[model samples]
Target: MTSLVVVGSGIAGLTTALRAASLGAEVTVVAKAALEDTATAWAQGGIAAVTFPDDSVEDHVRDTLAASAGLGDAAAAGIVAAGGAEVIAELISHGVVFDTDSSGRFVRGLEAAHSYPRVIHAGGDATGLEIQRALSAAARAHDGIVVREHEMAADVVLDGGRARGIRLLRGGVLHADAVVLATGGAGALFAHTTNPSVATGDGLAMALRAGAAVADLEFVQFHPTVLHAPGAFLVSEAVRGEGALLVDETGHRFVLDVHPDGELAPRDVVARAIADAMAEGRQVFLDATSLRGGTAENAAFLASRFPTIDRAVRAAGIDWSAQRVPVTPAAHYLMGGVVTDLDGRTSIPGLFAAGETARTGLHGANRLASNSLLEGAVFGSRVGAAATSAPRSRGRVGPDAAGPGPLPRQAPPRADLPFSRRALQRLLWDHAGLRRDAIGLTRAAATVASWRASRPAQVADAAAAEDDNLLLVAEHLLAAAHARRGSVGAHVRSDDPFTSGKTAPLPEATLIGAPC
Candidate 1:
């Protein structure tokens, strides 16, 4: 039995374990897959840390608040920007080598938001992998840390009114005085995503089941430049920062003609512009050929940035250096998650959350460029330090005092469930893509609801999971989409494109049969 168990081995989880172990606390990390396969590994853009000489904390803070669309917590955004440089320096100390120009100065790339170049990357676009490799290596080597790869955390065990430990399958029970949930995001619920398959809202679902308060479920960020093809591999927005244009089927540069900011506008604007162009029977392209400093060398940079996307494009009989890669919007980030304070403490004592799974209001309606990774590092370390100092339980948990036992199993995997997930994905794309109407949303919601109601009864009781976990996640997302009514961020409403509430808050989940 471990003293502290952390779920998800991405940057958030790795940082959490590292900080705690550094403070002399025993830590155990449980992951569903190899440490390298988490969503953090798939991030193509660099981490947006304010490191440039001209950059100011206020400017960075303002950019984040602007992207959040107004409901963003001002205080939290400030805290995030304040710690930007320190965290970057900390990563450097940990041997996370970021990319630099030939002169050895940090090579900065621009993404949506900020008034200047303030992004720090690793090897051009493999920031996620670089950071993960360093942190994972450090965590595994720590004497106080124990990593259990392939062991998935079923749920957070709750006893009385506090978090006690986490239960798993490979290992019967791992008792802990405290548990840190750094589970990634719910990006996998959507068919077209920049996230990995393991990001199935496990942290969000598990935290909610453990009675943690979550927020901003309604705000989802869809990266506007994913390559629109068979697999829809994402081409990084860094391509735009490096001088690419969004053009229409007529080969006319369109974004410049529509919005003043053109291709450089925020993600919401670009995604909508592309959708509108598609609605008018036009396909959009990133016109990189005509820009200054645009050449095969630029494509070489892109190829280096995302090897997976590059290889896939090559297989599709296209040379990106000389040709335009087709583009579309795919679900990318969840701006909200389990609610937490600056230190990452959840509503429940002894439980901490960080990363995309915890909606700390840092990214309000929409997250700025690379702040997602920075948030995972900045607050992730703070939370880990806080958890390390948490007072240990005076007495061991007795059998009668142990938490929500063995935890609850997610609905098991099944073949038909994949079909249901795809169906829901299509429905969401059709109705809730860049725009939405009450009629389509209601229809989609009702269909998903009917499926949920008909799912096996065993799922209602955690006794033995029935059906598949994917279906449950789909049901909840559809339900929440139906509950929200506004055109804020990515949760746009066609029936009411105008804002509804002054600050439209996301609805609290209403589980049909939660195992209390």
Candidate 2:
């Protein structure tokens, strides 16, 4: 049997495994934690697609590219946008339940940057959890799939040009026909993020180690309003979609100063606005009190749209029916990763990537809200089917000579001297947070280069996350940010704001490359 290994167990990994198994391929799911504990299961907004009859593929595609800034790859964006409903239908066929009205048509939701109300939802805002339930149930009984929970993929075992297997913690050297790494993003590299602790950009880091190219590493998106209470709870954009307003400390509406879309402007702009307000000594709030532009009844409308947000508000000693919920910016999404083609094949032959860790060019500078889940599901299946056909000779690669391997590791430090994972994350958040100056970027790049310069000596270490991995991933991101001398999309450089003006055309495009 040609064994195909899927190294992530989220929506992307699960869908890929299911599709590949159905194609009569042997599949194994390797996860760092429980299968359901991923960035996908925690998503709040529903998938965006042209579900309703009035919505056209052109409309959805245009809106998506418009939101992508000028950096969108037009063909990739069009393919994903047009394929949206087909994937949603496929999800339904797998027993994933999306919300529907009495007429039985899928109930839709609206978010910013879209021209139509085409997002298919589930039990209000629990869309991610509901879809996960369906995918997980399918994987459990998939006779051809072997699930290795808590089995973390430490590195891709690359011999020459193609992938043969991976080095994992639970199972040492597991040979495979091909590999797919959909292990989410590097959001955990920040002090505050909505992503699970496991989301430390493992897939990106692993791929880079194997000489794969990554793109747009600097464009990290921050959610405009995550609850500022302990642990930094997420206040979904669905709350704003349901008519909440962004107000200041004195309860004054403040979003209009940024964009006409008001509370619904793209995430990066909104996040910076909220952060600036907080820095000015004025508290930020999402006032669900009076609704967008309606009456008293509009105030309570948010409760019906997003029960999770309402519940969180209640838990935090506030009521959406009568008060403003406190919120702040939190690191949310990364718009860059291992570069891949439309079929999900990365720069490395026999290796593929999907989800947030793969820059498929569908989400250019900024991702449209809720489009991520839809993208993951669609491309992951494509990766799986193609991967199933790869030659599984295992070649000259030897077999495992051991039992269950070492435990999966967290992010590692560099060779000679070191800092903890938390320390590395703190350092990124401090100097590389929202604003950027030459001094700050130089310091970050110099530190990462120093780390990268130490990798050749530590190749003999058995630890999963050697200092080499951290330096490579960190320096890749900083190098991209350094080359992108202008502020566009999620890359906000405070010192170089006016670089991309009309008089001077912004040739400011950065593609896949390794750090020097």
Candidate 3:
């Protein structure tokens, strides 16, 4: 029987374990915290898929490519887009109950850059929580899968140039025929992120150390609407789909001046617009007060459709139904990581990755809103089945095999300031955050390198290990951002001379409201 080690227990990790177990493989899932603590659970926008009759796979693929800024792999986009229906059905089989209207039709929503209303949610804005609950329950019920919680995966155990298992931070090793990394993204690398505390780029750092090739580390997606209050609560784009608008302190809809889609523009465009506004000493706000004509019916509708967000907003002492909520852009997702093929095979044999940990090229430069959940479902199953049948020996097959050459290695310089996770986050936020230029990236790279030089050889605890991983990933991210001189997708080089005249005018259109 095949033995597999699945790291991280979000939708991707759990889905992988369940699929592998059904295929007669014994699986062990390792999680940094409790099984429920994951970026997936924090997701509010629901998964993207072609469910309605008006939506087609071709249209979905086209929207994905357009949002990617022509850098996305068409084949990859087609694969995920075509697989959406099947995966959505599979999620239903796993007991995920999506929201439906009074007539029992799925409640579909429209997000920025999507041509159709295909995003489906459950529990209103608690979509991720529902998915996580159902999948976690399913995994717990499976006899062939073992759950190991409160355990951090420190490294990938490699042997003979192939992945053998995982090294746990608390101690001991779990050996397996194949190892799958579904450990989420590096959102914690930034000071303000919607990801939970455990998203420290541990999987990416482990892959890098294991000699795997990673790509597109420069394209980090910053969400345009995180509540500017404490905790950085994410205000889902679905709210905008429901007719909310973004406005400056002077009551101007500034995003409309940047793009004709206004609040419905691509995430990177809206995020950078918000950043530019803040840079000019203007605060941004999401004005949902006029949603549904701002009547009592509107308040009830908002509370019903976005319970999670409503509660969070009310807890912050703001009635979003009546007032504009202060918002800012924050690191939301990473579109790059250990590069993998459609089957989830990384450069290293016996090493596979899925979900946010793998750069499957489905999301090119910028990720279409709500595609993250679909990627987890579609590719997580693929990785599970692939890992179950992976051969003991195989040639390099990832980015290193077919793409550009490997990234240049840089030696760490002498230490300067004392290293702290907060300081690292702030540095990345300032230099590598929403908008970056050559000088800021160069300075950020040197500072990160200096901190890497002072890292302890032995990680004392989980926190220390996270700090080390953050530093390593930060260095790589800075390097990638510095190397890419042009602005594209989520990676904006403010000083790029070639960026002028790149953007054409978008056709004006009315903001889309949620499907009735």
Cα RMSD, each candidate: 4.2, 4.9, 7.7
lDDT for each residue of candidate 2 in 122-160, tens digit (9 for 90 to 100): 868888888888898889888999988877677787756
Q: What is the Cα-based TM-score of model 3?
A: 0.93
Candidate 3 or 2, higher lDDT? 3
Worst 10 residues of 1 by lDDT: 507-516
The estimated TM-scores of all candidates read 0.89, 0.89, 0.93
TM-score of 2: 0.89
lDDT of 3: 0.87
Tell me how far the alpha carbon of residue 301 in candidate 1 is from the true structure, in angstroms, after superposition: 5.3
lDDT of 3 by residue, 362-461 (tens): 8888999999999898889988999999764343223222111122334655657678899999999999998888788777877787777666677899
Off by over 4 Å in 2: 292-303, 394-396, 399-418, 448-471, 499-513
Which pairs, if any, clash in model 3?
A: none
Backbone clash total for model 2 is 2
How much is 369 displaced in model 1, in angstroms?
A: 0.7
Report how far off residue 457 is in candidate 3 (Å): 1.1
Of the two candidates 1 and 3, the one with more favorable lDDT, higher being better, is 3
Segments in model 1 whose C-alpha atoms lie over 4 Å from true places: 291-312, 396-419, 457-472, 500-516
